[model samples]
Each structure stands twice: as C-alpha cells, then as structure tokens.
Target: MQIPFIDLKTQYETYKEEINKEVLNVLSSTQFIMGPQVTKLEENLAKYTGAKYAFACSSGTDSLLLALMAIDVQPGDEIITTPFTFIATAETIALLKAKPVFVDIDEATYNIDPKLIEAKITPKTKAIMPVSLYGQTADMDAINAIAKKHNLVVIEDACQSFGAEYKGKKSCNLSTIGCTSFFPSKPLGCYGDGGAVFCNDDALGAKLKSLLNHGQGKRYEHKYIGINGRLDALQAAILNVKMNHFEAECKKRIEVGSRYSKLLEGANVITPTIMSDRNSMYAQYSIRVKNREAMIQKLNDAGVPTAVHYPIPLHLQEALSYLGYKKGDFPISEQIGTEIMSLPMSPFLTESQQDFIVNAIKA
Candidate 1:
C-alpha cells in the first residue's frame, strides 16, 4: 500500500461540495479581486486568532514584508530572528535593506532562544521575529519581555502554527505583529498562495491595511510606499469555508501528532516535543534521526513518502551569504538541519496508514 504525505486530495474529496460551491459563488459574482468574501474572511480570522485586526496578503512572504513596512523598519536596522526558520523570515528584513541578526535556537522547541536575544540587540535592532517552527509557538512571553525591555517590535512568523495556541492565546495574536501562510500544504490552506497579517495595535493594524493596498489610505491616495499585497477574493472565499471546520481539524491534528509520538516512543527517533504551555497544529510531524537520508530511502522503498521541512538553515544559504555567517555560528541549527525528517501527516490520515508508516520506520 502506498502512503501519501499530506493527503490534500483526500481532504478535498471530503469537503468537495462545500469547497466547490464557494468557488462557484466567486465565479458567479465575478468579484474576483477584493470582494465581500475578503472582508468576511479578515473578520473571521481576527475573531478566530483573537487578534484585534487581520489583513490578508498575496503570500506569506508578502505578509512578512508588509509587517516590516508597517512597523517602519528602516535601512541598516536589525531584526533579530532564529537561523533555523524558512528564508522568508529573514529574507524580508534583507529586502528592506535592514540586517537580519541571527540568534541560536532552543534544542527542544527549535525556536529562537529568548535568553540569547539580549546579547544580539543593539541600538539599531528594530524588531524580534521569532518563528513558531513546526506548528509549536516559541516562548513568546520571554521573547516579548525582552522586546519590551528593548522597545523593539515583535513579528511572529506563525506561518506553520496558525491554529496552534500559546499560553491560552492563539499564535498569531501572541506578538506585536504575526504572519501566516495559506500555501496548499499548510494546515489551513487555499488552492494557491495566500497569507495574512494579524495585529492588536490599532495604528499598526491600519498601517498594515494601507501597506497591503499599494499604500493607499483612500482611492488614488498613496499614503506611503507599499506593494500590491492584497489577497485574492477567490482565495478568501475558499478560506472562509475552511474556517468553518478549522477548530475541529486542529484538534484532530493534535491527536494525530500525539499518537505518532506514542507509537515512536523508545524508537531510534527523537519525536517532536510540544511544550506544556502550548499546543501545536502538528504541521509536519518531524522526527530527528541521525541517519536521515538512509531512513528516508528505507521509508520510500516501503512506499512511505517523507520530506524534510528544511534541509538547510537560512544563514548558510547562498542567497544570504553576504551576512557573513559561517557553519559554526549556529551549531544547534546546523546539526538539527542535518537530522530532521518529516513523516506523513494530516488530519485525514487513518490509523492503518499511520501504523504502516510506523512499522516501516521500525523495521
């Protein structure tokens, strides 16, 4: 039997009618741009995440960029972030001509070590952008306390942790500004690229809205330089339908992740550690193994598909070499990058499928 990683097709089959009807409604209305659905989605997202406001953007990259622009990140400014996250987290800072100040990650959570943040901050440090890697939130309270002491902004890269919670609050609403992706493989995804920015600061929220719409405060009025970052109405409509069932889906994801850990216990794998203060959405269900490549090959031979959420940390990438980072700069990130591997994961995965995957790993 063949196992699939992230069974989107099966999920679509389950929700075909609801998803198809929403797409058809968009086509029928022909309001393909900023239609009513977009506003409705933003409202629903804000309510769901408990963020005072939410602004949809074209992609997760744009969501990060818009957050930086809204917070007035300037050239030569520095933004502190983990080196282990996806490049977009640091790429946006570099795009603004601001510097990305790399910090090491905690071993357990694989998130930026808040204790090390103080040493990285300088007068030019403008923000702290911690990623909630693999669906669990960083220690946001500790990160926030440091940011508060330094008077810096905090932009949470919540792309992989949209439905996850931290200390009773949602991931997106736990920081000064939060960004999340709606890529096809994400927990709550659309047919194509999409993302959203969330904020509790009213002024920053309004600024983010303007920045997403070509800096227009009103029609034909350019308030500040911005990008065309608006989310498509079609994507918005699709997301609204997903929102109806997202809570239940998230709960199921937690259950699935727990089962994976329980089954893998005492095996030659290091299962993901979910902090007691928070719950994960289990976006990838990554496991750490010394011989990742061999394990991947063995799993593939058994018809079990696997993937690496990130094979290389951002600091070592060719795109960011100008940052002058060397391999030894972040030993933990480099080491983990070599060992982390993702298994088949989704709310729709069945008990038999999970058993098959686990047995393949053990064998």
Candidate 2:
C-alpha cells in the first residue's frame, strides 16, 4: 500500500479553492513585497500566538537573526542552546560572530536540560535560545527563571511548534522573543519560504520590525545593519488561508499522535513522551529504536516510508568544529542522533494507513 511521509499534496487538495483565490488576489494586486496580505498575516499571527506584535520575515533562519539583532547580540557573546536541534538555531548565533554554547538534552523529551543551564552561564552569556524540538516546547518557566537570574534574554526557536502550548500559554509567546517557520511542511506553513518573530514587548517588537527591513527607522534610512528579510506578500496571503484552519489541524495532529502511541504500545521502539503541562503539535512523531538501520530497512521493504529528523548533532557538525566540541561533549544528544527515526505523520493520515505502518513495524 505504499504510505507517504507528510501528505502535503492531500492537504493542498483540501484547501485548493481558498489557496487559489488568495494567490490570485496577490497576483492581481502586483504589490508582491510586504503588501496588505503581509500586514494582515502578521496581525493574525500575533493574535494567534498571544503576542503583542509579530514581524514577518523571509525565512526562519532570518527570523532568528532578526531576534538576535534586536537584542543586540554582539561578537564573542555566548548563547546557550541544545546541540540536538536543527543547524539554523546555532547557525544564526554563529553568523553574528557570537558563541553558541552547547547544552545536553533530556533523553525523554529531546529538549535542552534546563537543570544544566546554570553551570554554563558566564559573564559573557547574553541569551538562552531553546528550540521547541519535535513540536513540543522546552521547559520555559525553568529556563525563564534561569534567564531572569542572569539578566539574560530568551529566544524560543518555535519553528516546529507554532501551534503548541507550554503551561497554558502558546509556545512562541513563552519567552522574550519567539521565532517560527512557515516552511511548506510546518504546522502553519505558506507556499514558499516564510517566517515571523513574535514578542510582547512593544519596544522590542518595533526593533524587530525595523531589523527585518534593512534596519530602516524610515524608508531609505538605515539605522542599524540588517538583512533583506521581508516576507513576500504572496507567501503571507497563502499563510493567511492556512491559518484559518490551523486550530482544527492541530487537534487532528494530537488525535493522530495519540493513536500512534496507543498502537505502538507493545512495540520495541520508544515513543515520544509529552509533558503534562504542554501539548505538542506532533510535527514528526519520531521514535527511538535500538536497531534503527534494520528498522528503517524493514519499513522500506514493507513500503512504509520513514525518515530521520537529524542524523548528526550540531556540536559534531564540521561547520562548527571550530567550537572545539568532541563526540562525548553531549552524551544524550549524540546517542539520540544515531537512534531517532520519524514515521509517516500528517493530520490527514488515515486509520488504515496508520494500521498498515504499525503492523509493518511490529513485524
């Protein structure tokens, strides 16, 4: 039966009429760059995430960069983050000539261990950037407490967790500044590369807005150095349509994730463990298996496609080798790097397809 991972085509079909109308509207307006759609999307995003303001940007990486720039992260400054996350989290810090201090992750949640953050704090520590890995937020209360004690900023990499919640609050609004992606496969996505920065502080929000538009306090006036990071009006128009159904989609994702856990209860793999106070969007529905290579081969032979969220931890990547990290630096992250595998996950996945995938795994 050939199962697919992330059935975006099916989702597209479901929203085809609305999506087409939005796209056509943008095309007809010809105000493609930061037009009315972008403003409307930013307002909707801010309201959805409970943030006071939102700044739309070109991509998630740029969103992070804009957040850091707003907080005035200077060269040689240190920012604590997990090594198990996507490279963009650390790459943005490095791009500013700042140092990314690697912290080990919790084995169960696959998030940066908040307990270990204190030991890493130095006078040079400027901020704490925690990634909401796999659609669940990190322990924000504890991380914020630590940041408060140190007088450091906190930036949440909410790229995979746009609709998720932490302690009854939305993920992106849980910290000082939140950055999220609108990639085609994200929980809330646009047709092309798109992202946004969210913050409750009005002053910081204005700074983020200025930073996203070539550091312009006004048109043609560059105040601080910035990048060309404006989200296209077309992408914003597409996302506006997607946002209308985001809540329902999130509910469906939770239901599908719960079913996967129930079906795989007796299986030899370790399913995700969500915290009691938070709800995950189930971006990937990943699992940890003892023999991942064999399991992937078996799943492939059975026509049940699988994928790995990350094969290498960021600390060990060649690009960041100059950070002087070794394999044993983050034991938990290194261990999970070799064992984690993602299953076919999407809000549109059917029960029959899930049954087939689970039966193949059990075999």
Candidate 3:
C-alpha cells in the first residue's frame, strides 16, 4: 500500500460539497477582492483565536512582513528569533533591512530557548519573534516577560500552530503580534496562499490594516509606503468553510499524534514532545531519529512517505551569508537540522496507515 505525506484529497472529499458551494457563492457575488467573505473570516478568526483584531493577508511570508511593517521596523534594527524555522521568519526581518539575530532552540520543543534570549538583547534590538514550530506553542509567557523587561515587541510566528494553546491562552493571542498561515496543509488551510495577523492593540491594528492596503486610512488616501498584501475573497471564503470544521480537525490531529507517540515508544526514534503547559495541533508529526536519511530511504522503499521540515538552519544557509554565522554557531539547531524528519500527517490519517509506517521503520 502507498501512503501520501499529507492527504489533502481525503479532507477535500469530505468537505467537497460545502467548499464548492462557498466557492460558487464567491463567483456569483463577483466581489473577489477584500469583500464580505474576507470580513467574515477575519471576524471569525479573531473570535476563534481570542484576539481583538485580525487582518488576513496574502501568505504566511506576507503575514510576517506585515507584522514588521505594522511595528515600523527600522533599518539596522535587530530582531531575535530561532534559527531552526522556515526561512520566512528570518527573511522577513532581513527584507526590512533589519538584522536577524539567531538564537538556539530547545531540544525538546524545537522552539527558541527563552533562557538564552536575554544575552542576545542589545540597544539595537527592536523585536523578538518566536516561531511556534511544528504546531506547538513556544514558552510565550516567559518570552513575553523577557520582552517586557527589555521593552521589545514580540511577534509569534504561529505559521504551523493555528489551534495550539499554552497555559489556557491561544498561540496568536500570547504575543504582541501573532501570525499564522493557511497554506493547504496547515491546521486551518485554504485552497491557496493565505494568512492572518492577530493582535489586541487597537492603534497597532489600525496601522496593520493601513499597511496592508497601500497605507490607506480612507479611500485612496495614501499615508505611508506599503505593499498590496490583501487576502483574496476566494481564499477567505474557503477558510471560512474550513474554520467550520477546524475544532474537529484539531481533535483528530491530537488523536493521531498521541497514537504515533505511543506506537513509536522505545523505538529508535525520539517522539515529538507535548510540553506540560501546551497543546499542539500537530501540523507535521516530526520525530528525531538516528540516520534519518537512511530511515527515510527504508520507509520510502516500503511505501511510507517522509519529509524533512528543514535540512539547513538559516544561519548556515547561503541566503544569509552576510549574517557571519558558521556551522558551529548554533549547535543544537544544526543537530536538529540533521536528525529531524516528518512522517505522513493529517487529520484524516488512519491508524492502519500509521501502523504501516511504524512497522516499516522497524523493519
């Protein structure tokens, strides 16, 4: 039997009729830009995430850029973030002509180690962006307290963690600004590229809205330089429909993740950890294993598909050569970069399929 890494087709099959109807409604209305659908989605996401404001944007990358723009990131300013994440997290900071200070990650959560954050702070530091990697919320309470002491902004890159929670608070609401993705495979996904930024601060929210739409405070009135980063009404409508089933999907993902952890117990793999204070949405069921490349080959030969979330940390990537980072700068991140591999994961994943994957790894 063959198994796909992320079976969006199964999920689509289950929600096809409703999704089609919603798409047809958008087509019929012909309000394809930021229309009623986008407004409704923004409202629903704000309520769901417990954030006072939400602005849907073009993509997860755009969400990070918009957050930086909302905060008026200045050139030569520094933003401290984890190196063990998608390049977008750090790339956005560099795009603004700001510096991205790389920090190591906790071996357990694959998140920025807050204990190491204070030493990295400087007068040039403007913000701290901690990514909620692999659908788990990072230690935001600690991160926030540190930011407060240093008087810095905190942006949560919740790209893979839409429904995740930490200490009774949701991921997006835990930071000064929270950004999430709706890429087709995320917990709350749409058909195409889409994302949102969440915040409780009103003035900042207003500025974010302005920054997303050519700096408009009113109709066609430009106030500052901005980019066209608006979310399409079609993606909004799809996300609204998906949001209707999001809670159920999250529950299913939890069940699948739990089973994987239990079955892989005491095997040659290090299971993903669910910290005592947080809940993960399990966007990708990644595990640390020895000889990850060989194991992937073994699993693939047995028809079990696998992937690596990231093979290279940003500090060591060619894109960030100017950062002056070498291979040994962030050892933990570099180690994780080599050992981590993602198994096939989705809310629609079946137990038999998981069993097959596990057995293949054992074999």
Cα lDDT, model 2, residue 259: 97
TM-score of 2: 0.99
Shift of residue 312 alpha carbon in model 1, Å? 1.3
Model 2: per-residue lDDT, tens digit, 118-159?
A: 999999999999999999999999999999999999999999
Off by over 4 Å in 1: none
- For model 3, residues 73-170, the per-residue Cα lDDT tens digits are 99999999999999999999999999999999999999999999999999999999999999999899999999999999999999999999999888
Candidate 3 Cα errors over 4 Å, as ranges: none
lDDT tens digits by residue: candidate 1, 1-363:
867799889888988899899999999999998979999999999999988999989999999999999989999999999999888999999999999999999999899999899999999999999999999999999999998998999999999999999989998999899999999889999989999999988899889999999999999999999999999999999999999989989999999999999999988999999999999998889999999999999999999999997889989999999999998999999999999999999999999999999999999
| Prediction RMSDs, each to the true structure | 0.7, 0.7, 0.7
> What is the lDDT of every predicted structure here?
0.93, 0.94, 0.93
TM-score against native, each model: 0.99, 0.99, 0.99
